[model samples]
Structures are given as structure tokens and as C-alpha cells.
Target: MRGTPLRGAIYGLLAAAIWGGMYVVSDVVLKVIPPFTLLTIRLILGAVVLLVIRWRTA
Candidate 1:
């Protein structure tokens, strides 16, 4: 699309923000929870969030 540059910039910023949040939250959770369990929780949470977004758009 013609908006590729703008799209890329927005996605890059979004990725940075997401990873920053991920690091903070995982650090907190890892103090008590195991890595695998944390991963499952993160993945499921991401999936549910994405599905909700998709449903709204569609």
C-alpha cells in the first residue's frame, strides 16, 4: 500500500511498547510463576485480545 512507511513506523513503535510492557510484567510474574506457565498465560492473553480486535473490525 501507499502507506507502507507510515505503517512500518507505527508497527515499529507498537512493537517496542509491547515488548517493554512484556518485560515488566514477565519480571513480576516470574518471581512466582514458572516460565512455561507464564508463556501459556501470555500467549492466551494475546490471542484473546487479538480475537476481540478482529471481531470489532470485521
Candidate 2:
């Protein structure tokens, strides 16, 4: 697929939404977990979700 400008903008907005939600969730998780570790877990989860999407599409 071509990396069209509009496609990039849409993806960027989606990523921003994910990050915005992460900030709020991380704030709540802060009560129980350290920030760095919480971020690590979030990263891992995000990676898994992306991988699953790729797998299904491919």
C-alpha cells in the first residue's frame, strides 16, 4: 500500500488517541505500579495488538 499523506495523518491521529488514553490509564495504575514498569507493559501490549492485526491482514 502507498504511504499517502492522508493515510499518515489518520494513523497519526489514531496513535495520539492511544497515547492520550495511556496517559490517563497510567495515572491510575501509578497507585500500584512504578511508572517505568507500567509503561513497559503497555508497550508490550500495544506491540501484541499490532502484531495480531498484521497477522490477520497478511
Best candidate per TM-score, number?
1
TM-score of each: 0.57, 0.56
Local distance difference test, per candidate?
0.91, 0.91
Q: What is the lDDT of residue 20 in candidate 1?
A: 87
For all candidates, the clash counts are 0, 0
Q: What lDDT, from 0 to 1, does candidate 2 have?
A: 0.91
List, residue by residue over 22-48, the lDDT tens digit for candidate 1: 878878889999999988988999899
Tens-digit lDDT string for candidate 2 (1-58): 7799999999999999988997788678898999789879889998999999999999
Misplaced by over 4 Å in model 2 are 1-24
